[model samples]
Target chain A: MISRHGTPEHLPVRPFVALVALAVSVATFLWAGTAFAQASAAWPRVSPITIVINQSPWFGGFSKVVEAYEKETGNKVTLDVNPFAGSGEKQRNSVRSKEGQFDILVMNSAWLAEFYHGGFLTPLNTIDPAFKLDPQVMSYDDTGYWDAARKSNNAKTGVVYGVPINGNIQVLYYRADLYEKAGLKVPQTWEELAANAKALNSPPNVYGMVQRGARSASDISYDWMPYLHSHNGAIFKDEKAGDFTVTINSPEARQALDVYVNLAKTVGPPNPGSYGQAQVIQALLTGKAAHATPVIAAWPQLDDATKSAVVGKVNVAVLPHGPGGRTTPTLGHFIGGIPNNIPKDRQVAALAFLRWFQSYDAQVKYAQTGQPPIRSDVYAAAFMKTPEYRWSPAVLASLPNAKMMYTVPEGPQIASVLELRLNQAVLGEKTTADALNTAAAEIHDLMQKAGYKTARLPPLK
Target chain B: MRGTADRASAKAADRWRFYTLAPALAVYLLLALLPIVNLATMSVHDIHWQQGAARWTLVGMKHYAELPRDVLVRAGLANTALFALIAVTAEMLIGFALALFVSRIAVGRVLYRTIFLLPILLPGIVIGAIWKLMYNPDFGVINQLLHLLGLPGFDWLGSGSLAFLSVIIVDVWHWTPFVFLLLLAGLETLPQDIHEAAMLDGASAWQELRDVTIPMMVPILVMTLAFRLIVSFKVFDEVYLLTGGGPGTATEVLSFTIYRRFFTEDRMGYGSAISVIALFLLTLVIVLFMGMARRRMHAH
Candidate 1:
């Protein structure tokens, strides 16, 4: 098609440009195809398989175990790790939206109800019996799984939905140096704790105590649940009736809020409403406060040089008693479950990986890293015998009595209301009674809107 | 014969020009007009999310009936109107002054013009984030400067009243440049002979400006005001990131309210209703503005 020399030269350039464009397009298409093929291949295969963990400590120890398992079995094992923070709700929501994205989800027990109800997770009972009996397999402790946590994991039809991965119970953290300076012992009751807090108040440099006052799902709800339970407050009465009728408007709940708000006002910093889990930890770590009630999972941060200022001076104990005369810690734990959409072969591989991770050896390794083990035997193992972790066993022993947050479909919404009302009371915008009454009314209205029946009061025992 | 055919065709075209506009009208109806009609229909319904299913039922003007009684909704509407009035007025005044100054400049005029348009070039989100850091209570430059001046630091985004002002300030900073650029272009294209003639007659600068320049700039000014009003009415990003509609819903604008209903509350029907009401209100305001401009133009 060449005519003039100039036109011929121009024609070559055009073809060259076209050739480059075609090559680029082909390369891109092949690249995309290969990526898709690689992604599909990464999906769990039937034989000895791979399990991806999107959690913390479990991924740490489980990764090594998976490698060993594959080496011994002569089958390839792949594990992917995803770390998250704050509440685990976002992670749970992710799995619910994208099934098969995770072969096994490492999630908090609090989310089990939502997961099971939404059909996002598979029940462990359906796994192959051989892998189910694998002692190395991580499974929920039949005895150690407390009533609240168990009830949370129980499907409406009474089927177990998840295997407990680790246990977490709330504890009171205090600075021993400050307690000594104030000539106070560890507070045993809420009244005593308040007294100690007031005594330890030193002004702009330091405060007596700090807790999570921030308005968020986890920050406000975590510490409040124990207080509600200690004072015998019930979020709801009848599950079948869907009655989310009663709230923390009872005398006990009010007393708890009153005590909590009063202490937060007098001893808390200028902006108590902005404080959350990390801030509470910072209060104790930087010696800004003498005490805080945080989950046991955060205790490890106290010893990390980068995070804590009072490494050796910090100590942990069960939460103080309320009017009930019994200390009740809130139980929080992570559990593992297979996705129902995962291929059957991959499910077997996930079960195999879980069995190894839950073995006594692996659990002990996890305990040594400062996470509480779910197994009864692991609590008395070599890890707990160490001086650094001697108190962890005591914390673990208290897990049996710990209470979980309410697990109804409306649980999150009710918790949001409580958080908002509690924040108002703490900020002195409303009295404890006033806040509770308003919250109770709002919660009752929400329950009615959800079509739940009103619960009748039970006769006294 | 061809010339006669062409003349006849041209005459017939004049009679059927309306048909030529039909496709555009059809597209607008399908995309914009129809969705608005659908939104108005959906607004009066209750909707909830259960097991990934959205259930909706007609509640009739119940949401609207409740609107007057809902204190937060009322406060939000009042705040939005107040924000639009104050913020748009300030932006227009400041923008006009900048455009006038830059238009009179000689040396480095192009450079100054580019610099004047720089704020408009940056994204809204970036502007909001930069302003948020500036207003931070603890280590922000604003507080640091206040401390340097031996004055007590103030919570810019933390205080309810100040948070609203802070968002307005950021809006003016980002969007005034847009108005300035528009006005500057209008200023450049204005007829100079009228101003020169007035100056020759010993007319005072204020008199000449009030009587000549401003009158000529009417159409451009109206266009700028209309554009800014529409944008300011949908203020979302800055307020959302800055205050999150909080320190107790002080900065909760209508857009933020609609977003919360749609995403957080999962009440799509209620959200759709709010959107419909907002759309209707916006349309009414625009029409009123156009009428006023038309009247002013006719009077001139």
Candidate 2:
């Protein structure tokens, strides 16, 4: 309604233009604020990632983490859970055949070398994916990590492939009431363990010990590791030697096998040679067994009144000492990694998920949910205050001495080779020494054929 | 010219039929034969994903040569033979009796047949799980029943040869129905004249069973026994679920052995070699049995 030169009905064109500019300025400011808020809430929605996991507590715990990450980052996580039997092999077969279904894969630490060398795993360091671990959501405390755990995933070239998630260590689970009634001490040596077991055992009612003696790559091998390690036997003499020669044939190994075979014959479950951890666990839970060497991670289930019959009646102690004068349990851990086939963005997203998952809060929740913790700090004074986590002290005690299984490119194959022979010894089909020697020879042949630097070391002096 | 036209039209019709069937035939070849050819090829090559991307190298018959010396393979073969012998024998005898008994019944024959068929209709996994529960040494109903009878309980799946026998029991329970159904069909198809003549001759039930039923059911019996052997040799799911070829490989069979080699050990080439060998063994058994069956038919 304005005319130029101050006419009566004219308004100033500059004022109209200024009014329009003012409205535009206010609207722009409001839009900018909303956009900033939205950006912070969800920066980039990642393409969906597929994951494979066994039905371990870690898998269950990670499902919760997946839900949390989805809300936080606007990314969808697809979980493919495998059953307890042969899940490891299925994952490997599918991924190696380029099924293109998975973005992330989780496997045992024993399998790290096999997967890494096979190019199925991406080196986490190249992407430094752990950097995506949010400090607020995840514990960044260096002290929280166990010895070498933080850096254990690093390859020889200093590339990191796997991120440690959950770990396992073995402890002696004993019937405390039975021990008290029998007037026995917690056995410290293998000789004492056998004697105590034999003393407490009565046929057809109660047995001295229950153990997994089934001839499987995972089942009985894990049960045997503690004895093997406690006897100072190892699968390899010097991994650094490059030839990676196995040392399971030493006298120490034979001694361990002898103890195992004797236990099955004298005080173990009636058919211990045919059963695995499930049977052993069943025996212990039902009060049929007075002693067992169950993984500490699984002990919480034994303490829960809802799941176990021997709640509060069972107690944990260090594993009985072998000839080496100390107790040792075989080391096992489930580790997570981005598959090498994943594009960089998906790998980064997987890293983000892991970083948060391995955070302190998540590990605490993991422990709360009956999984053994991978962190050192979880057992520190403040965390173990909860009464439900009855085996934390024993787990902490066992962690320092846990010996990881042979981790090599040929690890899975080596395990099968060793398990078959070990079981043969258990069944009295072969003498302990004979089984060890045969197994060692076969493994040596396998390594030599695989073209590793081939040198068989003499017995450790 | 008219005859040539007619021939041309008939040829066109035949070609059309083949074209219509081509897609299905192609799919069948792809699904069945390709993997077999690939497995044979792989058996001769050292192909494993142990180093990640399956490293393929031609290794000849190394895996086959290793089979005899391989302890697991030998154990698997022994166990499979024992399983086939025990399980097939039990099922055949029991199934034959049940068929004869049911056929003699004048009432509720359909109901009895359905009840007998129930176990086979259930999935193998379900049967395995149910039996595993029943075999549990501690609280399983089987042990409880033993206790009620004031007899000592046995560790059904936990000890020595018991594990093998336990798996056989499961196989029997699941597959006896199949034998019964087949033999019952054979029994029904038999001419009533033969049985009538036996009855008219004042033959007792035992005599009739021995002379008439036994001789008449020979073809079906042979087929059933031979088929059961092949299925029993390939016993995997039941054993895998129940005992996992355990109690120190007491129940290990050829299929389970192949699975262990192929998957657990990551030795695809070795496993393929074992499979090829098993294929040949099974083929030989089938061919020999078929030839024997033909001979027996001719004799009849």
Candidate 3:
């Protein structure tokens, strides 16, 4: 039907349809332009990168640092926090999945070998040739490198695979008030520490000492590593030298075991074999024990008035030395790395985050958040001089002398054996010599089966 | 002609029955048999992840051969067997007694049933955590009670000798209610005419229970025992949260070992091999129990 003002009504409708088409074309052009602009602006990444980390004392601080990173870079990051054991499983699953789940893997020192040996990680140097690990951060006994040709972890020649995130190391936690009352100077050797334990010896009311002798996958063995390493004993003859000899049953190790067992049996809690990290910390905070060697990360609870009965009474010191040996704390640092399975863009984004994380400012923020800073400069920060940060000095002093348990991928599997046997020894189920010998034998069989040239020490006669 | 038509109708009914079952059977096969087949395939191969892809290296019978020598596997087998035997027996006996006591009650029966079933209502993980705190030597209620009595406190789950027993106690406490509920249902469904007949014959209550009621309840008892035994064999949460196969593998069970191998050790091939064996053993148990049940029912 024709309209009165126009030649035809459909002629007026033609312009309306044209207007609609023109608007849609303009909208499509604008949308495409904005998307292209975003693609250009969001260089290297548009999707969020995920970091898999275990829940630990430093997790809060680490999460804060991650938030700082996100704010600074405008890059999205998903912090996939899991329980300690669950994190490892998550990392393994992520790396093994068809498309990896995590961009960054926060690996425990114990499991670093598995990641490194399995080629599951992307070497940082390969990502950026000029990206050098900050020298101020603790090297964790050169755990960041893997000598692919030598099949060993060595900082001097191996490729850089990870950066230290949490500077975790064992430190001697002691009741300073008890020491003052007993008129005892700080112990310089394991022997002296033991003597002091004997002096402060009391049961039920207060144990002379409490040790983490529980047999989780690696708890007891981890607690005993300080003793073992300080005693000039090693799980291998020389892991750095590519020597795969099973030396856990060496005479030095036997003596170390003897000391560990004696302290656990005589001075520790009644159920020391069941005392994991939590139990040890509880014993210290409640003033039920006078001494312990928990990770420095646990130092925050010592002075927390809300949790501690003996606040301001505890002090930190380097783990005592063995005869003819220097103080050696066990390195329990958590290192962060990119898995090889992720997309190149994600890998780049992860590397960028790590690079920013290692900056001096980030380290300072990390320290401010009550996390153990990995950098030496952060350890010497003004805030560390306060009474609350009293443990920082000892942690700094101990980290340089810290040693990783093993540099082999078999570290965890082998640690399982030691954890069980050492726990048995602590519980008086096996003699120290018998336990060490059995551990060495089992480790030898394991390494050999894994196609390593390994041999155990002769049985302790 | 009429007989032939009836025969043809029966054959058509059989065809209809087959058609009715086909879809369900296909779905069951797809869900169940595929995983079993995949597990079998994995057991014969050494699997390694390379750039997020599983690289399968054929190593036929290697993992299976290593199973016998694996100390953890052996310990797991022994502990699992021991745990099933003791825990199941305790649950069955205690459950039977509770069922008998509740069935005879004329008042507050529903309340007693609810109270008895409370343990099973709690999640296994929650139960494990609660029991762990209760067993703690320092501040736990068990030791605190002992201390109040001026007696020495004992480390219940810490000692190698006591850890396994402590776990068993937790299992028995948690699952007894399950058995009780089942047995009570069985008791409720038992015909009352037999009990009345026995009473009219001047048989005592105990005699009626032993000779008339128990004999009638044997099939149900056997079925309940088998179910409890199967569940007990799969115990992991209690062991995981409480002892974690600690105090020198005292409480290590098959499921925990498989968990360690798969998750902790990342030995998928070996873990699958262990799983295959466990599945086979469990299936055998199920088959044997069903056979026994059928035979007992036939005898009755």
Best by lDDT: 3
CAPRI-wise, candidate 3 is acceptable
What fraction of the true Cα-Cα contacts (under 8 Å, chains A to B) does candidate 2 also have? 0.69
Candidate that beats the other on TM-score, 1 or 3, i.e. the better one: 3
lDDT (Cα, tens digit) per residue for candidate 2, span A164-275: 6667667898888888888999888889989989987887678887788887767777888888878887777765334466788887887888898898889976767777
Pitting candidate 2 against candidate 3, the one with the higher lDDT is 3
Stretches of model 2 off by over 4 angstroms after superposition: A1-45, A57-59, A68-75, A128-157, A179-187, A202-205, A453-461, B1-30, B50-52, B201-207
- As a TM-score, model 3 comes out at 0.91
Could you give candidate 3's per-residue lDDT for residues B171-258 as a string of tens digits?
9999999999999999999999989999999999899989998989998898899888788889899999999898888989999999
CAPRI-style quality class for the chain A–B interface of candidate 2: acceptable
Q: Could you tell me which 10 consecutive residues in candidate 1 chain B have the lowest summed lDDT?
A: B46-55
Worst 10-residue lDDT window for candidate 3 chain B reads B46-55
Which parts of model 3 are misplaced by more than 4 Å?
A1-47, B1-7, B49-55
Better of 1 and 3 by DockQ: 3
Top-TM-score candidate index:
3
* Winner of 1 and 2 under DockQ: 2
List candidate 1 stretches off by more than 4 Å: A1-114, A127-157, A164-170, A216-223, A237-243, A276-286, A294-301, A307-313, A328-398, A455-461, B1-75, B107-133, B173-220, B269-271, B287-300
Candidate 3 local lDDT, A337-456, one digit each (tens): 898888888888888888888889989999887668888888777888988888888888887788888887777788888988998899888999999998998999888877788777
Better of 1 and 2 by TM-score: 2
For model 1, fnat equals 0.02
